[model samples]
Target: KNEGSYTIGKVELEIKLVNRGHVSGNVKGGNFFKASGFADMFGNASKDYQPQTLIETPILAENLKPGESRRFRVVFDYPPYFKGVTQFTRIFAH
Candidate 1:
C-alpha cells in the first residue's frame, strides 16, 4: 500500500512455482503471469479506486514434472495517485 500521496516506486517480486500435480505439464506458448494492484485486501475497487495492471509477461517454456519448481521475477511500477489507502496485489497464472 502506498502511504504517500504520490506513487512510491517500482516493486520487484519473485515467485517460486511448483508443479505438484500428478502429471507433467508444460509452460509454453502464451502461458503468462500477471500482477494486479487493488484498492484493498479483499480485491474490491470503486470508480475512484480502480484496479491497476502492474505487470504481465509470458513465462519461459519449460516442462515440469511432479515436484519440479521454477522461479519467476517481475517488476511492477506502482500506480500513481493512490494515497493513504490500503492496497493489495494479486498474481495470476494463465
Candidate 2:
C-alpha cells in the first residue's frame, strides 16, 4: 500500500489595526477533498477521505500596531481520524 499526504495551500488573512486602534478582516473557506491521487496505472483512485464541517473561530485584535506584522499561531485539536492529504488551514488576523 502506498500512503501519501501533503498540504496543498492555506487560508491566510491580514488585519491592519489603524493608528486609531481599530482593525477589520475576514476568514476565507475551501472545500475538503477525499482521495486526490491516482491509485494505479489503470487511472483508479479512492474517495475515502470524508469532508468535515469547518469551525468558525473568533478574532480579537489586542495591542497590535499599524505597521507591525506577526505570525499568529492557531491552537486547536484535530480528531485522531484526520490523517494526511492536501488541505487548506485557517490563518488568524489580529
Candidate 3:
C-alpha cells in the first residue's frame, strides 16, 4: 500500500474534486492513521490558507480492522487559482 490519503490545512474553496477514499467507522472501518496533505494553491499562510481536500489514494487493503490506520495522498482535481494567480508557487512543498 504505497498510495495513501490527503490531509489539508484549514480553509474553504470550491474546486473540482476527484474521489479519493471513503473514511468511515469508529472500530472496524479504517480511519486515517496517517496522511500527507497540501493546499490547493501555493502561497504564504497569511496570504493564502490551506483548505481541507478529499483523499484520493487507492485502497489496496482488502479489509480494514478497528484501530487500523490507512495512509492516503490527497490532491485536488484542479489547481487552486485564487484572485488572478496560482497560489502554489509560494507554498512550501513537502
Candidate with maximal lDDT: 1
**Residue 71 Cα positional deviation in candidate 3, in Å, after optimal superposition:** 1.1
Top candidate when judged by TM-score against the true structure = 2
Residue 65, model 3, lDDT: 44
TM-score for candidate 3: 0.20
Candidate number that wins on lDDT, 1 or 2? 1
Q: Order the numbered candidates by TM-score, best leading.
A: 2, 1, 3
Residue 79, candidate 3: C-alpha displacement in angstroms: 5.3
Give the alpha carbon lDDT tens digit for every residue of 1-94 in model 3.
2123533222222332322232332223343223244334442365645333333333223343433444534344543432121223121112
Q: What is the alpha-carbon lDDT of model 2 when measured against the actual structure?
A: 0.34
**Could you tell me how far off, in angstroms, the CA of residue 39 lies in candidate 1 after the best superposition?**
16
Q: Write the per-residue lDDT of candidate 2 for residues 1-94, one digit (tens) a residue.
A: 0011432223344322111101122222333332233432223334554323234353433344444344556554544444432234444432
Per-residue lDDT tens digits for candidate 1, residues 4-60, read 344323333333332221122333434432333233445653556444323344443
Runs of candidate 2 with Cα error greater than 4 angstroms are 1-51, 56-60, 90-94
TM-scores, in order shown?
0.27, 0.29, 0.20
lDDT of 1: 0.36
Indicate the residue-level lDDT of 11 in model 1: 32
Q: How large an RMSD does model 3 have?
A: 18.4
Lowest summed lDDT over 10 consecutive residues: which window, candidate 1? 17-26
